[model samples]
Target: MHDPAPMPEVQNDEEVPLLGAQRLGFSAGSQRLIRDIDLTIRAGSRTVIMGANGSGKSLLLRLLHGLIPPTEGHVEWCERPLDTAARNEQAMVFQRPVMMRRSVAANLRFALSARGIRGAERAAREAEAIASARLEHLVNRPARVLSGGEQQRLAMARALACAPRLLFLDEPTASLDPASTHAIEQIIDQAHDDGVTIVLVTHDAGQARRMGQDLVFLDAGRIVETGPVAQVLDAPSSAAAQAWLGGRLYLDPTHSSQT
Candidate 1:
């Protein structure tokens, strides 16, 4: 019922635990989806990944989460490798979440318990996550059969249930209805305020602006631009970035950007 501790003060130029990439590239067999990308999102900051589908936005998040190993360079969270500790410190929510075939409460319990949560503390944390997403009514429902929107909220709840330091979201609101999307975004903002550094991938400009302090624009396996969202959107550095924001879609969202 009680809110968690307030987010710590994060001043620019202050030493922060960063989720960083230096010339990181992701390859599949021989296909490289991202290349020569250097990015550093400060701890407790909110960053967005914006681009047309298959611009390597999702892949880049995976690489950052250590779901996929980079073919070149490396990703680090605060100078440490994305080992178990780092992975535990970070959590990712996908557009279509991978869900457990259990009640929503059970799913939360499974995830949080895996993170070593227990006792009244775990119950409080689970309730907090559900309440934060405004999903208290659905906590006892079957997680698998939930509507697309509710499912997404549960995914978010599961992610937040761990109280991770870093959160990665790959179009978390893409399939939800507007109200559900709004709810999810609100919870995301709350999460940001709670001191979890965020890397959010989305095509929705409005969501990006609301949630992102900075943006990374990717196209054809390359980073077209990286800067404050206001700067990058208002004055895109490249024609590709311009076209990307204009919704002239060129990349496929289905396959890896190999060519």
Candidate 2:
């Protein structure tokens, strides 16, 4: 696919919301998977979304990233409607990333190429991404043959290769070992330091605290609480937040409370 036409850059003011969703909702058949989510992602913030297994954390992420249209409301980027031009500035890494049937270096090349980069610039980005992900030794190996952690690292490298302004991750380290998880977090940290806005979804509380500046807690497809990571995790005021933090099963009052 060809790259979308370039969009004029937004000013670098940190206070400006880079992305926003107003009353966002998503439904499948008779069930509303996401409900009335009003969210703003600052230009240089690390926002983490956390919730139970069926709380719609992933769904919310998808909506915010414009991977799927919301059933109600809309998403905006840089105060404009979210469209192809806006989405071109974003990238997402999924739980089980799909690698192309090609070599590690080839995958990185493809990503940069897709962004309309070429020649020396593309080569530099490929090298930098490979080095950042510590995949230099495996550059010649087929991406699909790499281990789970290696593949995830490559996925991150591929996403970052495009130099996106916003990065979305959904359980990128859910099945990795501690070392792999740490590596992934380091990449995320580096990306944030480079002014890339981060929005991640993870069930690991410790990971949330380590990577998040702000937290969004979801319960029953709705936002229950949002605040600084420390406050939300330590002194959560909402019952849903409290229950999830305390290891108790959170039963949304609207649903059955009895087991």
Error of 2 at 91 (Å): 0.6
Q: Summarize candidate 2's per-residue lDDT along 164-223 as a digit string, tens digits.
A: 999999999999999999999999999999989999999999999999988888877878
Give the runs in model 1 whose Cα sits over 4 Å from its true position. Answer: 1-15, 249-259
* lDDT, candidate 1, 1-259, per-residue tens: 1112122222344458577777888777778778777777787788888888767788888888999888999988788776878899889999998889899899999998898889999999988888877778888988998888888888988998898898999999988888998989888988888888888999998888888987777776777667778878988766677777776755434434555
Q: Superposing every Cα of model 1 onto the true structure, what RMSD results?
A: 7.8
Each prediction's whole-model lDDT (CA): 0.81, 0.88
Q: Mark the 10 consecutive residues where model 1 has the least summed lDDT.
A: 1-10
- Give per-residue lDDT, candidate 2, residue 26: 90
The C-alpha local distance difference test score for the whole of candidate 2 amounts to: 0.88
